[model samples]
Target: MPVYKAPVEDTMFVLYDVLKMESYGNLPGFSDAPRDLVEAVVSEGAKFCEEVIQPLNVVGDEIGCKRNEDGSVTTPPGFKDAYKQYCEGGWLSLAFDPAYGGQGLPVTVNAIVGEFLSSANLAWGMYPGLTQGAMAALHVHANDEIKSLYLPKMATGQWTGTMNLTEPHCGTDLGMLRTKAVPNGDGSYRISGQKIFISAGEHDMSDNIIHLVLARIEGAPQGTKGISLFVVPKFIPGADGEAGKRNPVSCGKIEEKMGIHGNATCVMNYDEATGWLVGQENKGLNAMFVMMNEARMSVGIQGLSQSEVAYQNAVAYAKDRIQGRSLSGPKSPEKQADPIIVHPDVRRTLMSIRAINEAGRALVLWTALQADVSHRSEDAAERQKAEDHMGLMTPIVKGVLTDLGFDNAVKAQQMYGGHGYISEWGMSQFVRDARITMIYEGANGIQALDLVGRKLGAHGGRAVMAFFNEVGTFCAQSKDDAALAPFVGSLSKGLKDLQAATMWFMQNALAKPDNAGAGSTPYMHLFGLVAMGFMWGRMAKAAQDKLAEGADERMTAKLATARFFFEQLMPESSVYLARVTAGADSMMALPAEAF
Candidate 1:
């Protein structure tokens, strides 16, 4: 079995030292989340996940989930007991409103807890992970009665939740959906349709499953404009607010997927299930986006989680597995062969992944703090600025992290050679599980397009411009500091490349939109490199300050990783910039019939 020790100390370093988290003390949740409290929460969370959740990862993969004759699904053994303990621990309500029986903590704190759980067991984590999105949607759009009836239970994990959107005919194009909802006499709608690939769609873990579904109301506007959102529960709530008779909804089947088999990706059937409308009529997409956006960010964390675990295992293997004599010399003369960690090529691979994992963790935590500011900050201007940064970083977080995460998984697996191919070593499971993150929660290709097509220009490019200014200011401020010169210089060059790519898109994409389409993925990656470089710059500055204050060996290690990122990883932005400038000519030149 694979071993997982949660990166709690690293998380604290990013939260407290690098980001200066205490600065947000005035915020609602931050005031309560003092350093000691935050550390205690993460430490406890790490213990729970490492002890309770991780043991089920390989078991979940092997046994998976099963569908019974009654259309109900059964998860792997110990899942239900684990979930019960999880809910009893109040793990589900850490970041929610205290009025809803939550701890009233910041999303950043919840995000940290989520990282530990995901790293330990991603498939098992999806059950509660999807519920958070569902709760966010209902909290934002659902009416008071819906909130009163569902939000509290959902928050406490007594009733789990799901987002039901995709059908067999549609995934990305919501305008093509065929699901239908007809108004019943007493202010309720009858939702009747099938939703496919619904993660955590059907399970016996909770008392009730509250499904936030999307369907078109009768005679509404055509296409996406006609769509409406609905809250359809597996068991309808009675007047006393408990689950009553079973509703008409049922799971038709579960998807036999390449990974995350533990999560029952169900094909659901709704036969005129009693449902309540959420948000406004003909504005379903707007409401559904709340869940999608949250899911997208959560999915990005999944990528980071897998990368962390893979890197841990790879580092362990590289140290213990003796391969050949070190190129420098036989340092371990008593042994027949030196460990692979001594090899230059092996070090390169390990350092590359280490750089991405650390920087990626910083990026995710930084973005999570931005999310907290967007939601909890008192100043309207501050909230708007944080929201802008959040929008700009979301796609990059989802795309770059998952893409590089999968790559790292493969690289880590390579470190194990043939053992990685077998099941007992458990490396292959990490590769398999990591692959789905790139495909789901809005595929990475779609994420790239969103970065170039939507987010770059949202709010008249205020967000992207804000991002540029932040990077520019950091680079400028650090230019004179000799200890920080390496990171600052690399970041300066990366910012220029990002700006040039943005200008190229502005200059060439309007007249020939294919130019934008063809370059979108590369531009997304370029933007991601700049983002990661900015994070590394911040980390390096913190490391420098800590070293000046006589911190410890960890500070030195942090400096080394930050240097590796600047020297080895950040330069790739220029290559992507080159590709972005190349435009659509070569890609578009081929005739449709040529191949």
Candidate 2:
């Protein structure tokens, strides 16, 4: 069985030491989340994930979700019970509004919880994850009446939620969607549509499911402009706000997916479901993007979560599995042969995964802090800058983390040799689960395009420019510190590469849009490298500061890992930059019939 132990200490270090989260105590939720409280929450969360959630991972994968003849679905065994425990523990309400029955903690704290949940049981995680995303959308865009009726129930996990966007004919192209909503001559609309790939769409865990669906109102304009969002619950609430009547929405079937079998990815059929508008008419995409963005961030963490678990298992295997003697000599002379970890190639792979996982966690937390700032800060300028950071980093987090996360999983599996391919070892599940993160919540390619095509130029490039300035400032400040010289120097070079790539896109992509399309993926990764390198620099500085006060092995290991990141991973920025500037000629040269 695969084992997952949440890196609670590392998370604490990043939260308090590197990010200095307590310094923002003036913020709404931050005031409630002191260091001790946050530590207790994370530590308890870690224990819950390790002891309760993780044991069911293989069981969930093995049994998957089952759909019954009544159009209702049953999740994997132990999932429903585990989900109940999760709700009673108040995990879902950690970062939500206190007015809505939430604990009112910092979003950064919730983000840490999210990583733990995902790492422990990703399939089980989606059930609540989708609900949180839906609640966020409703909180932001839904009318007061809707929020009052739904947010509290969803907050406490009495009612879960799902986002319904993709139809049978459409995935990314919302304009092509044909779902229609006809006015019922009252406050409600009659919705009729079929949405596929709906995660946590139908299950027995919650009393009701709140589906945030995208549909076009009758007589509305065509294309995406006509799109509008609707709150279609499985059971419509009565005057007293209780689930009184069964709505016409039902699960058609659950998808036979590549992985995450424990999650009920359903084909939902809506037969004139009674629904209410979420925001304004013809502004569905605007409203749904809120949830999409939230989901994208969570999906990015999913990537890291899988990679972290996979790395842990691989490390355990490396230490125990005896293969051959170390090239330097017999390190374990008493044994038949040395452990696989003694080999240089094995060390290289483990270090590579460790380096990225550490930096990736930091990046996730840092970006999540920006989210807290964007939502909670009182200053208008601070909010705008933080919002810009969220917009700019969202795609990078979603794209780069998943892309590398899957690669890391594969590398971790490679450590197990042929056993990794077998189901009993559990490494295969990690690779399979990690694979979906790259494809869902907008594919990595779309994420890259969003970065290069939209986010990069939004608000006249304010976000990217701000990122450049912040990283450049860090590099400049740390240049003179001999201890941080290597980290700062590597980060500086990576930042320049990102800047040059941005310049290339500005200069070349407009003349030939294909150039932008061709270069966008590399640009996203290039941006990710610099962002992670920046994180490493900060972490190195923190480690050095801790060491100055007193020496510690943990801090020392942190420095070593940061060095590995700088030496090995940061240089990839140049390779991606090369790809970014290579242009689209050869890539697009092949004619339609060439294949």
Candidate 3:
């Protein structure tokens, strides 16, 4: 009843033409990678997701995940086999280093591959995607012996990984966390904590589930500074690398949720589990962020994936379903009515989704490029700038794109009219699944607070300023490029609007502390919109330059997409600018007792 086709052309355009990611091929660690390999991998990956993984979408959501009384969780009817297929196809380690049985692909290409995989079946796709994040964290923080023990199998996908940070009483505020760990003198700790909302927590899809958990050590500091990370497995591995004995890890229950029914969200109980410290003692929270950043970016891909699937379904429905007369008179008199696509509002909705998705895709891909630069650049200053850009852009990737992705989903459902609300159309699933994105991975509101309260003040806001200056320099270099004028003009306006909103928020937050919280979400989104618009404009500039030197029709399609983005999506900033500049009075006027 539903269909999705990977936007392979668009993906190629973003990877090769827009970001020009292969430019990094000259960098020391990345010298082995170039455009041809990038193209070959993404193309093959897209086809694999389309033919193998996507066929499982409906099956996954319908079958969901079931919990057994014996502390184990069963994945959707065929998830075990599907994930096995995924792992066997070498997808699990596409971006990992080659030393651990991975392909050592550039992360930029991996991001595109992730987008396609998720678009096909996000519910099932989340399993490996989240595991990749866990693997990355442990790889960064785990000691050599522990890494040798777990990383190889997890990277190869014989085993999987899960994150355990949230508990029943705590969601975003880790400061109130009650998870505890006690030292066991022989270079290990015993971890005991109840973690809620653990995705892929205790599933039977892998030989074992490796859990990277957060808990406070004995006599640790009272707040966030005391939190430490531990590696706790479901079953202890014997000398033969098999899970021989059941560990003290078990699932209390699986959450019954609105969407992502295919993926298990568990309430986990860790009872004095044997644990190994991944990083420095009492500095675990800082170490775990290695995984958190990766998780947050993957969540951003989920947002885009959700948007792409919803857009595809809605577009198909609009083209085929004919119930209304044309507004410009009778365009379909032979049939009794016209297709919904003939209507202006329907056109607007579809265009909005298309534009946001395309712009959002560009922003996401560019960030991935920066992420590669942060890790692989040869020069120290270049690496520092890349790291700064990655830090500043991470929240936007998580906060703004996801927010728009959900909006696109809602518009998609609206496009289907009442049919969208009914489960069979499958439109509702997009909205429901996308909702969790806003709440988790540090709620978008919190991301804004970090942007203004922390990142903005980081390095004296010079990181963000460098970002703005780069955008300005790009515009200056491209003003003479004829085909890019419209996108550049719109982007220039959006940038000014964002700059104004930033100045207003800075003044307000200084004058009144409450102003920061009240303006947080709006400010975050405003920044996100302007940031994406900047990317879109750069895309137009690149496409225009290529055209001046001579490109084919495919390049024209990009120009058209750039035009559509400027005309439609950039206007969103006006709305957020007002909300951001609204001051604290509007939000704080209501007393706590009024409710």
Candidate 4:
């Protein structure tokens, strides 16, 4: 069984002490939500996750979901009621708007809550996880009429939401999707196509399912510009805002994925499905990106959440399992054998995983904060800067978190030696579940290219400069904090390496377009690792300050984890930089005929 003790104390400290979330209340609509309210919400949410959903992790893994020939999907037993608890508790709408029945909590609060839910059961958690994306799309692109119709049920969890983007032949290449939509006599369109890998596409937990789909109109152009987004429901809504007549949409089949078995992955075959356009025709691709961004960040959090859970379970196992004597001394000779944590190599593995997990958590929270500022800030310059920061941070959130998250799971599994390979220990499940995070919501390789090829050059290089300036400012401010000297020094050098990589790309992008594609992925990781290291440095400083103030013992424990991160985690930059600087020669040299 995967044991998970909610890290609520650390979560509260990070939100209140490190980020000072109370200041967010002054940012317009949040005047009513105080620190007490936020803390209460977090506490209750944590408790619910630890109790209700955490037990389902292995149950869902072992039992998985069943897909019958009738095209209906079944989640693990008890998932429906557990999902009902989530709905009744109002988790789906925690951070959404109030007019739509949401509680309108801070996004940062949602981040912490989501980490708990996802860590408890990534597969079962994905049902609501995906609904949030569809809800986000409706939130962003749905008109007043559509929003009034759909947002409430989704908010109340009466209806679940899903984004149907992938097709039979297309994965990340949205431009090649063959889905088609024809205008009906009324305002609606008739959609016909096949969509694959649609998670929570067809589930039994909700009364209705709303699908945010992408399909091309007749005579539309041949690429992404030709694609448009539509709201296609499994059943048409009644005037009273409930499920009525059956819509034309149906689940053709469910995918046999290697993991996330409790979440249905559907092969949806739409035959003249009644649909409503979200934005303008042919401009749907751009509009859908709003949901994609929200989904991307959520998926990244999935990785981080899984890693954190993996660490929790791994730590429990390491303490209880005694295999050999301590190399330094017989510290635990009182027992039958020694704790694995006493082994230097095992400590290094655990510490390295800890360092990355902590940094990843901070980075996600910080990014959420930036997003909050971008949307809620009163000052124009502040809003613009926050938007720029978000643009730079998206790839990092999606790319870095997933990459390191998967690595953390593998490392945690490695700590168990042979048992890690066995499913009974539950460590292998973490590794298996973590794999999908990298592949879905846009593959990590594509994310890397986006960072180097697009985000760095966005706004004519100003975004990149803004990012560097923030790092530079942090370094300058921390000059007096000698404890951060090692981390800051490593961070500063990594910053320069990123800058060099950017300059190299800018200089060669046009003359050598292949260079960008060849070096993009490695360069993305190099930059993401540095960004996580930077965030960890900030977290370490905050923890150390608490120690200086004579705080709780948890503060000292956190400080030690931070110290381990700086010493063990910051050394991988050299290897990534080496691979990136090797450039397009090797990748390009393997010609079309070579295969």
> Which stretches in model 4 have alpha-carbon errors above 4 Å?
none
lDDT of 1 at 471: 91
The lDDT, on a scale of 0 to 1, for candidate 3 is: 0.84
Predicted structure 3, TM vs. truth: 0.97
Instruction: Give the alpha carbon lDDT tens digit for every residue of 1-595 in model 1.
Output: 7999999988999998889999999999888889999999999999999999999999999999999999999999989999999999999999998877888999998999898998899999999999999999988898888898999999989999999989999999889999899989899999999999999999989999999999999999888999999999999999989999899999999899988978999999999999999999889989989889999999999999999999899999999999899988997899999999999889999999989988899999999999999999889999999999888899999999999999999999999999989989999999999999999889999999898989988989999999999999999899999999988999999999999999999999989999899999999989988888898899988888889999999999999988988999888988999999999999989899997
Q: In model 2, what are the clashing residue pairs, if there are any?
A: none
Alpha-carbon local distance difference test for all models: 0.92, 0.94, 0.84, 0.84
lDDT of 3 by residue, 272-365 (tens): 9988888888888887899889988888888988999999999999999998798789778999899889998888888878878888888888
Better of 1 and 2 by lDDT: 2
**Residue runs of model 2 more than 4 Å from their true location after superposition:** none
Clash statistics: count for each candidate = 0, 0, 0, 0
Models 1 onward score TM values of 0.99, 0.99, 0.97, 0.97
Q: In candidate 4, what are the lDDT values of residues 3-80, reduced to their tens digit?
A: 777667777777767777777777754576687887898899989999999898888888877777877888898899
Off by over 4 Å in 1: none
Clashing pairs in 3: none
Pitting candidate 1 against candidate 3, the one with the higher TM-score is: 1
Off by over 4 Å in 3: 546-553
In angstroms, the error of model 3 at 383 is: 0.7
Where does candidate 1 have its weakest 10-residue lDDT segment?
96-105
